[model samples]
Target: MNPDQLIEFLGILEKLKCNTRHNWSTSGRQESVAEHSWRLAVLAMLMEEDFPELDMNKVIRMCLIHDWGEALTGDIPAFLKTEADEKTEAGAIESLLEKLPVSLASGYLAMFKELSDLTSEEAILVKALDKTETLIQHNEAGSETWLPLEYELNLTYGDEVCRHFEKTQQLRDKVREHTLKIMEEEVRGHREK
Candidate 1:
């Protein structure tokens, strides 16, 4: 909660990047670094309550700080999000946190580490929430929306994901139906004469 450290952190956070497919509100408008983090946290809260077996507070902390590294490495797109890129970002996070006070650095580093999935539970929880956000956003966006142009999944990971996570599974299926079935009607509402 140190103002000096927070200001530094926020400055770093401003440098974070996100995927190109999912734009902020307007087509040309871009989402901010803070906006990405906040939405992920919201996704965690929305989905975590259904996982009665795990610690969601941990999930919230993980999602909130997941891209603090992006403050250092910039957001890597979902398609280009490679292991080497992650390794590079990892190094950046470790170095940045080292500059902060020990107490703050310790907590920040721990949250960042959770994204690495040092353990099965932590890895699964973070992955589920991360994928869940994209899945739901995809449904909401439909074919006309921009993301479909850039991102692609093999279906294996997605099928496996929805298979294990019931809450997301419901949304995953629902998003498809809603987008496919109602998209035409929605467009018709705003169509030019």
Candidate 2:
């Protein structure tokens, strides 16, 4: 891609830095979509040894671009997102991809399709890590930041996806344990108040 094309493509992605997710950070601020994607990619990288047979690079790539659609639509929490919302995001992604060179656009279009299909090991790992990352972030955020349903959602959100890999399942189990602890502490604090 030429300098101008690269800059234009990046300009579209720049919105991800400004797009806020539903979850708050541990430091008590709304988390940006970029922040979540950055950490999710890191989380994928951290599992390299655990998934030696898989393409860690592809998993990392998936993690990075999984939410690029959100740059256009902002975030719609999983619970609230419907089929129409997904179609809208898909359309947004296609529009954004059109700005890129043919080679790059086609490659990304394939990657996005692979991610949606979730048939490959890399796709499955990325999807599992994506859910696990969200649960971990929710656990990190203060209980006061949580909606009542999130207490349960955090415990159960990634169970099916995480079940695809033993390591991810273990991680999900640990996060659920932490979620329960947080719930108990919040309840006790409420009673004390």
Candidate 3:
């Protein structure tokens, strides 16, 4: 909760990937896990006006730690999955959360639970914003590989998925446009290289 936690959180940053898939950036432009959460928490505050009914507290909390599991188990590309991988990440979150004092820990546990449970409007929007941010990143980075991006988009489904949100649905079109532009540029760069 103090400045020190922020510093310690950076150690976990090495593990989080900005894109689910590895691409052009050598370091993956991969944000450290803590930065991702911190940024998303900001996103929730600035953008929750879009979801007026959402519990802003839960949105902030969920955005803050949706990927702490990534801190322990490492991030996975959205397109690939194994039962073992999922379990390992879940266990990592459990272990990491246990390190917190009871006073500080309970709140994180509840937020993590909310993300997993996906029961609230706040959780839903936080989840949507998570995906939305990544897509925005991909477009900004102008990634070339369509398969990975396409694969990631294919992974979401039903109500729990972020793509279910209307704002993101429109944003999804933006993802496609930005991705296509990035791809075109990459192709040109590759030819010159």
Candidate 4:
């Protein structure tokens, strides 16, 4: 790509740094889309050893770009986002990809297709990690940040995808255990109050 195209693409990605997700940080503020993607990529990197059969690089790339569409549409909480919202985000992704050179755009389009279809092991791993990352963020955000519905969501949100792999399923079990502990603590605290 030319320098101008590179600059334009970088400029567009900057929006991800500014677009906040529904989840809050432990520091008492909303997390940005970029922050979530960065951590998700890092999480995939950290899991490289555990998933040697898959392409960790592809999984990392998926984590990084999975939400690039949110840079345009902003984040709709997973629980509240409808099928229409998903289509809109997909359109936004297409629009963004159009700005790139044919070579780059084609590669990203393939990745997006694989991700949306969840047909490959790498794609499935990324999806599972994405949901795991969100659940971990919610737990870190503390109970006060949670909506009433999240009490249940925190426990059940990623069960299906995580179940696709034994390791991911084990990870989900640990996360669910933590969610249960948090709920139990909340209940005990309320009773004390």
Look at candidate 1 and tell me the lDDT of residue 115: 62
TM-score of each: 0.73, 0.98, 0.71, 0.98
Residue 129 lDDT (model 3)? 76
179, model 4: CA deviation in Å?
Answer: 0.8
Q: State how far residue 31 of model 4 sits from its true place (Å).
A: 0.2
| Candidate 3 error regions (>4 Å) | 1-28, 144-160, 184-193
Error of 3 at 5 (Å): 9.8
Output the better candidate (3/4) by TM-score: 4
Off by over 4 Å in 4: none
Which pairs clash inside model 2? none
Taking the tens digit of each residue's C-alpha lDDT, what string does model 3 give over 1-193?
A: 6677656655554456432333222344544555656767887788767777667877787787788787666667555768888778778888876666677778787777777777766777877777766656555545543355463462342224556678656655666666567667777999999
* CA lDDT of every candidate: 0.65, 0.92, 0.65, 0.94
The total number of steric clashes, by the backbone 3 Å criterion, in model 1 comes to 1
Model 1: lDDT equals 0.65
Q: CA shift at 107, candidate 2, in angstroms?
A: 0.9
**Candidate 3 lDDT for residue 154:** 28
Better of 1 and 4 by lDDT: 4
For candidate 3, the per-residue lDDT at 90 reads 77
